[model samples]
Target: MTPTPADKPPSQALFSTIAARYDRCNHLFSLGIDRYWRKQLAQTLVLKADDAVLDICCGTGDMALSVLIHTPVHCVWGIDCSETMIQLAQEKRIRRAGRGRLRGKTLRLSVQDAAALAFEPGMFAAVTCAFGLRNIPDRARVLAAVFRVLAPGGQVGICEFSLPRFGLLRSVYWAYLSRVMPMAGRVVIGDAEPLRYLARSIDHWHKTVRLEEELAGAGFVDCHCRLLTGGIVTLTVARKPGPLAAQPFL
Candidate 1:
């Protein structure tokens, strides 16, 4: 059975405690490779002019902003369970707007649980989540919510950490995850518990979860995964059944 929110206080509290230092720790821990991963996920969306995109678990709006900057999407909506994360995302939107980087595109962010999206059905052309799904105890429910909100033929791109298939690489990556990452998190965030949880969650997901299969079960077709950075990360892309409407913008 899927766990309730009450049963998952650690995950939400972890994010809240580290929200301010989240972006810094992310970049530092990943050696700045996460930016490229987000860009890769954004490119897979193939967003078109006037296409609306929804970003689930969009902490600090990085993934959503990447989509807006990299694609010609009309609007991007981001939702996160952590209010502090959502506030930081809003601050980022305001700063980007002040710098004229938004190009008049709309950016909306709110504190909403991924398992229960509040948006209308078939409201989005594409959906994205980066480094977030594994934290949710009920990822299947979140995928269902994503499937419901996406239009027919809408695409979904998910970026997640995974163990490398190559034995040596996997060992090395595991060491870094188990040791160096949490150590760096201690220095960056002043707490190692969240980073430790991150490592454990990634390990658990890599060993047991089949995201592509889950996507298919959630009514998505053409589900596939592409490993990046020596399989340290996986980008899973899937499409809803039916005619795809958005053409790539020139």
Candidate 2:
């Protein structure tokens, strides 16, 4: 059932309406560079056996799967509120059985909320959320929840859209996002408001420095930012305090 905007909860409706087109629309809006970001994240993340990682807002589980493929982590836990998204991810996981790569890694998929995670405290060695932090309505709560669930020294890596570094390019990108993205979205997936909401989130998001401050405020240590796609996107990495995370805990 495709939900109209009038549905009881609009965000859920919006996500449900677009699940089928979500991946394609992402590729379109990102100009196909988003895949590269995921690959880079997977490569950069250091993982080890007995490391249990959580992936919040794990839509379609692409980044989680990328992590699974790239590292020898003991397990990957993916949670998303969108049932359709989980279904798609599950299907993909099943299809990839032929690859015989995940035989030893446990990949758990569940429909769960980001702001209020169900996992036990100190459960994960690291957490990753790709293009997910913006969609969470309670950013602080989600960060706190993530902090709580992570083991001491657990790290988090977030990949998300950001304002470009250069003023002229930022202006051009913002204009295109605000003006043309919705139109193209309408043609591509029959949904414009969601894309517009995405644009607004990016437009109004805190700068990278402020984001790093927010992470630090949430008790993460040594927070830093890395610009990607010429600063059209940013990857913020932070770690929970303590020594276990000095190296991936086996």
Could you tell me which residue pairs clash in candidate 1? none
Q: Stretches of candidate 2 above 4 Å error?
A: 1-10, 98-103, 207-209, 247-250
Q: How much is 160 displaced in model 1, in angstroms?
A: 0.7
lDDT for each candidate structure:
0.84, 0.80
TM-score of each: 0.92, 0.88
What lDDT is reached at residue 59 by model 1? 93
Weakest lDDT window of 10 consecutive positions for candidate 2: 1-10
lDDT of 1 by residue, 134-232 (tens): 778778899999999999988889999888999998888888887888897788878887777777777778777888888888899887778899999
Q: RMSD for each model, in Å, please?
A: 3.7, 4.8
Across residues 1-250, which tens digit of lDDT does each residue of candidate 2 receive?
Answer: 1223322223766777788888899888888888888767766666677889899988888889878877787589999999999998898888775376677666799999888999999998889999888766567899999999988888888888888879899888878888899999999998687777777667656432377878988889877777887788888878889885544211
- Tell me model 1's lDDT, rounded to 2 decimals: 0.84
